[model samples]
Target: MDKSVSKSSQPSGGNGFPTSSSNGRKLNKKLVYLCSIVMAVLFFLGIAAFVFLFLLHKNPKATNKNIASFRVDSIFVSRFKLSSSKITASWDIRLSVQNPSTASVSYQTFYTWIQYKQERLSNVTNIAPFQVRGNNWTAENGKLVAKSVRADEKVIEDMATEMANGSVNFNIGLYAGFWIGNEEAKRVWRAVEAHCSDLKIGFSSKDNMGKLIGEPIECILTKTW
Candidate 1:
């Protein structure tokens, strides 16, 4: 009788192949954990940005009401002299400024001039800087003196007409450096212009004094730069 040989079957790399599959599973789990951590960081950053924008919209630095509060309180043309050759005049102006915000408002190096029919009649006079406290009002004064301004035939005619009418309308121009906050060093200065369309004054050919005709009129203020 012939003896039969028994055959045994076995897999290649016996248990090592199964160990490699286990390692692959562990690597996949690690990758998923890293992705989750990155997504969480992005979510927090987005939340922070949204909160900052919401707060900024709720509170603004300057408002229309606050800017509109600035006005010319009074104006006095104390003396106005007219001659065949030249014209001379002096005037006093007062400004009422109000600040409605929490920060202090400051005005500096202000200069003012008088105009008639878009013609500049006098030189600019410098006024000192002034500050208005938060939620408060402040009065500032300005003075102008025009001397020996050469008068033309048209100017004389205009003067006569105004004197006869008993009321002369003049425009006032103003330029100032301003800052809105308490930290003045960090604040930027800007130019301002004021126009007084309702200014009324009485001119007499015999007397040098020109009387104010009516109540103080409000001036329109605008930013130049």
Candidate 2:
């Protein structure tokens, strides 16, 4: 006799549509493959970030260009006399301030001091507000004077001895704030401090006028914030 197939005699997943268990297997495989792809992408991105940071660290000059430079061009002492109990002097200072960065810099009021044998002297003038463009420089002038000011006995003696030797050493300190900006707008101000040390001013007995000796003194720049 001719046999007939029943619905229950066929395979459980023999229909055009897969069974529930077969669908579950395919879905799990797709989820696993998606997760692997995501992980691979993340790993490559992390490697790229690491390489970029390493390159930046290796090349620091790219960021150092924002800083400026300062130098003491000349210092003239028109009069300087040290007595047993007092001191008297007149100093004219010239500074060359250069903006080596790509941005323009606007300076605030500058505070400058002169020191002899570590003793600060009285000053009359300060550097006024100014601005400089990229790769530009400016000459700043200041005056310091001491008119029969009382001095320490030790300092007076030391200064007198040094002056007789034809040269005297002094230190120059500068403190100020500056704003850095592009063409669009300006940013906040940053404080800076500079120190130019071991400045030698040589004097002649004939004229008694002292002038800076040797090469131009470069100031040590420090950023306060």
Q: All predictions: root-mean-square deviation over Cα?
A: 9.3, 7.9
Q: lDDT per residue, candidate 2, 151-181, as tens digits?
A: 7899888877888899989988888777777
- Residue 9 lDDT (model 2): 62
Question: Clashing residue pairs in candidate 2, if any?
Answer: none
Write model 1 residue lDDT over 1-225, tens digit each, in one string: 233222123334464255567779999999999999999999999999998877654433433333425567677786686777677888887877666656676877678888777767788998888887777888888888878777676876787678777778778887766677777575544455667775777766577667556776666777654
What lDDT would each prediction earn against the true structure? 0.71, 0.79
Residue ranges of candidate 1 with Cα displaced over 4 Å: 1-69, 184-188, 204-206
Q: Which ten residues in a row have the lowest lDDT in candidate 1?
A: 1-10
After superposing candidate 2 on the true structure, give the runs of residues whose Cα lies further than 4 Å from its correct spot. 1-66, 182-185
The TM-scores, one per candidate, come to: 0.66, 0.69
lDDT of 2: 0.79
